[model samples]
Target: MSTWTEIGDRCWVRRYDEWDLNVGLVAGSDGAVVIDTRATAEQGSELLTHIRELTDVPVRWVVNTHAHFDHVVGNSVFTDATIYLHENAAAEEDLAGTTFSVAKVIDLGDRRVELLHLGNAHTSGDTVVVVPDADVFFVGDLVEESAPPSYGEDSFPLEWPDTIDRVIGMLSDTAKVVPGHGAVVDAEFVRDQAGDIGTVANTISGLHHAGTSLADALQHTEDWPWPLEQLQDAIKRGYGALGAPRRPTLPLLGPGSSA
Candidate 1:
């Protein structure tokens, strides 16, 4: 079962049991914006039903935080709404939607939603939805609460901490942040998570610099911040990243800076 929690004025987060996913909604007098479509068409349809309980206005926009299967597979359900995906994420999935390389502003009749591509963290393309009026931010897997940050084959583990630092710099001290798969959180929570991710990234860097082989990497780190299972991908990806040219980091956005 899923439950809806109002995190800000007219901004709500719907939490689902599967994947512990958190879908966001920001309703306006003229229309609404759904943050993510869930994991499947049937799940997306159910999400649409849950949305109706908040407002009857048409869903004018759908923003996929990233191209992860769970966050975007259900996009087809929002047939009429204009879906927004980061250009990199668009390449991963052949979903028809408006693609933005850096940022885009969505006019939701009475509300303004800023879709920002902060930097590569969990995936090459991750969108941070900022509802300026409500001070509510829909940050996908960039900041996870249910578990440690996910570092998949596509994740930029080496740059994950820096990406998260940019997110922290852009948030207000009191902003209500709705993570992709967790309950609503505050800036402090985001800060702490950034630190943890930084530790993971730093550890990976140190191990790589110390000539630690990928297979023998885990053996060297006796004090693991995250579960060993979760760190496997992080180690692999981090090492891979360290071997390549680093991507430039995006400029830090001031608190409430939409662009």
Candidate 2:
């Protein structure tokens, strides 16, 4: 069974595993908001069962934090709620032919869910669901617990900090931040992670602009505050793919470091 943690009368967090993923449920006087649908149909159904036990209030809104399969594939289960996402997310869904489709949103209670496209951050399609009454923001992938931000080909690592700053500015002092993969955290934790990610991105940018070959940059991995073992592997793979020279003498760091 998925582990569920209750944060408030109206807020509960669900963890599938230590590194699996997480989803949030925000109860409302009239209805509720289901943060992310889970990675598979079965998982989504399990989550729905838990929500039903809490309140019979219809799930009026379903928010897709990002288009990652782990975060959005199960949206099919919420066939009755309006699905909302960032415009870029919708576009991604369209391109990939994921189970979710624009037509499905209309069929789901005829609710044309609002898709607000906040510019690039974790992914080009990142969107935060604001529970106005509950004063909670459900952010996906944008904030991690202790893990360094994962930079993907689609991610804007350099712009991530600014996006997080905007999110903090939009929240009240008491606003809660529910991230995509970890335990619920406060705005302060979010800021700290953003700062770390910014640092790594800046370091990479500087090295890249300095004509530091990928091999030379890997040699300078010590410059990063985090460990570089995992990143070293990634770097090696990247260089191999590009047919670039490999570097030696790279020190490895433990998991959760910017490495």
Candidate 3:
């Protein structure tokens, strides 16, 4: 089902229930701004159709919240709109860029979205799209409302809490947060999620640093709400981010081999 919630005067957060994917749309007299196109051409086409129902304004620009496949892979769908990405993503695209340490705001005529690049958070460059006037933030996967945070192979566990802190500072109690996948929530929800994820990061890092084997270290995460596979990935991210050696992939020994 295609459901949309009006967040501001002319802005909406559209959700495709099947994918649990949320895409931000902001329109003004001048043009419209689309945040994060869906993963494929077909999904992006469907999203465009949904956006067309909301506003007739032509989409002039597209902002990828991050360069993940689910987020940026739909770039090809927005042929007429200018695609913008963080410096690192630009590097991958081989485009000359500005390595913004803080953030930069793009004026969408009647609307303004501040792109804050929170270094080493969900990825090497994760940006939170802030609608200052609306007091809403389009947090990619940095803050998840549907589930616990997902740490990919590129995530930096040690830096996520601090990055989330930066996002928290930019929000107000009345602010609404649109996660990558889920219903819109408030600032407190985001804050609590960040705190819990931070705890997981710390626990994983501590266990790894204490020289706990990968299997035993994973046991410490049993109390965590995420899956074992996700925890294992986070453990690897934690170890890598902390400059610890990669977890050695030891072979399982059968009873005969053990003897």
Candidate 4:
């Protein structure tokens, strides 16, 4: 059980060793909001206990930054609170919660928490939770510090930079940025990450336009911002986004021509 670190006025982040996950909490006069529940109901229950350490305010809301299991599976623990998830994440399963398409403003009586879906970056359904008064942004998987942003089959490598750009637009100089799984960062850190993501996007575009085969793409570029192994999915998805030509299907060998 990791201890909670205060990043803003009443905003706190708890970092866990497993998956290096970070769970957030914001307290208001009347209620509190828990951001990104851990990986399971038991973890969520434990998170609630940690929240009690800071304030006994009732947790009235549960915001799932995306549909990732690490960020949302603990939703069941907050049985009384209204769980919120992006429509896309909700579509992945029969999630019992409120679904918002673009954005949703949650009022915790004394403070307002804004949930914004900037664009497709980490995932199509990635959500950024903003504690306006506290100048804190809980960007789930959009900005990572523990590791390079995870690029899976559902990731949007090309669109990620633009999505991060939108997040950058919302930050102030002293704003504390809590990643889904890392130490709290600032706007400058996010900008650097956005730059890296942009570089990868451009590299992928350049390779695709140059008629480079996906199989040989990695061999051509040696200076990737992230590890080559981690960027494999990025390259594959980037080429896919650009509609790069697929390998032609070879016809079966004729019996007469075969030895």
Candidate 5:
């Protein structure tokens, strides 16, 4: 079973597993809001069971952070709630033929949802859900807790820092942040992550501009303060696709060091 911890009177953070992902719940006098759904239908249903135990408040809103499978595939379980997302998320869902139903809301009881498109950040479809009265922000994958940020095919590394800044600006000073993965953190942690990622991106950009071959760039990244093996592989693949030189061998770090 997943673990649920209350952050406030009406807010809770659900940690499914070490790497399973986390979801948030915001309960109001009238109803409740569910942040990202789990990856599978079973996990999503598990979350609902926990919510049912806490309050009989009808679930009125279901907000998806992005279009990634882990973040949105379980949306089918929330057939009764209004499913909200960023406009780009809806568009991507349509293009990818992902099974999501906004129409199901009507059959469930005329529940309606709005898609608020903030802008491009983590992914083109990144969305932020704010509990105005509670002063809480449910940031999907945009702000992670100490773990290294994972950049996937859809991520825009160059624009992620600005996106983090925008999210921090949207929250109040006391607002609690619930990330998609890891523990709940404050605005300060968000700022630090932005700075760290920005530095890594800038370093990579500079290397590219300085005519450093992809192989050399990968080797140089071995000394990066942040964990970047995955990112290095991504860079190498990107360069290889463009017919760039092969990557050079990088020494493996001793078990714990960021190599």
Candidate 6:
């Protein structure tokens, strides 16, 4: 059986056994809004059916927390709903296939879902879904509880901590947070994770600011979470966000600076 927990009025977070990915739903009298379709069409179809069984409200909108394959890629299945995405999210190679960046507000009858692009962090188009009335937030991969936060090649490690801080600012003390993966959590869980990630980011930032060689910096991240290899990979992304190593003259995109 699929596992779900009700966090607010007609709002639920369904956790998939497959990837442990969390999908959020916020419903009102007329319709419902879905956050993060699954990785494949088959998975999306199954999820749609499960959601339909829970509520008769037709799915009116689908929001992608980010462009990651597991978090999106199911847009094709929800043909009737207006898919919402970040403007820069379309640049993601996997999501380049879909038409998005439309409809900021989804009216779930009286209750509403608002999409906010709080700068760049996880990915260029990472989107946060807010149900202010319900006091809930669906933060795609930006907040990870099932596992440690991941920093992909496209991730802005430097900006990630502040992005979490921004989400913290937007939430109420008792708000429920549905991360891209893992169990439904409270604001304090998010705060603790954000603090950890921030420490790692600040360490990398400090090393970079002090003109330490990238190699040495990677070595220094030995005590950070994740294996040395994974830590190195994440640090590299953080470094990339600052600029390419050695040749700082040819700078790439810096943290907190988005298109």
Give lDDT per model, in order. Answer: 0.86, 0.68, 0.77, 0.88, 0.69, 0.81
Global lDDT of model 3: 0.77
TM-score, ranked from best to worst: 4, 1, 6, 3, 5, 2
TM-score of 5: 0.77
Number of clashing residue pairs, candidate 2: 0
Which candidate model has the greater lDDT, 1 or 5?
A: 1
lDDT of 3 by residue, 55-104 (tens): 78999878877777777766677777877678776665453334445688
Error of 5 at 55 (Å): 1.0
TM-score of every model? Answer: 0.91, 0.75, 0.86, 0.91, 0.77, 0.87
Model 6 bad stretches (over 4 Å): 94-103, 221-226, 244-259
User: What are the per-residue Cα lDDT tens digits for candidate 6 across 1-259?
Assistant: 6766799988899999877889998888878888999889999998898987888888988888888889887778998887777767767654533343533777777888888887678787888898888898999988888888877788888888887898999877899998988888898999899888887888888788877778888788444756566666668988877874453455678999886
- Residue pairs in candidate 1 whose N, alpha carbon or C atoms collide under 3 angstroms: none
- Find the candidate with the highest lDDT and give its number: 4
Better of 1 and 3 by lDDT: 1
> How displaced is residue 130 in candidate 1, in Å?
0.4
Residue range 1-259, candidate 2, lDDT tens digits: 6766776556678877735587887665556778788888887897899888867878977877788888887788888887777667778766232223221221223222222445577787887766554567667888877465666656775566678877878776677777887778887787777677667666766666565688676777566756775355434333433444333456888799894
Give candidate 3 misplaced runs (Cα > 4 Å): 92-101, 221-225, 244-259
Ten-residue stretch with the least lDDT total in model 6: 94-103
lDDT (10s digit) by residue, model 5, range 218-239: 7774535476665764455344
Clash count for each candidate, listed in order shown: 0, 0, 0, 0, 0, 0
lDDT of 2: 0.68
Q: In model 2, how large is the Cα lDDT of residue 112?
A: 28
Q: Model 3, clash count?
A: 0
Scored against the true structure, residue 63 in model 4 reaches a CA lDDT of 91
Candidate 5 weakest lDDT stretch, 10 residues:
102-111
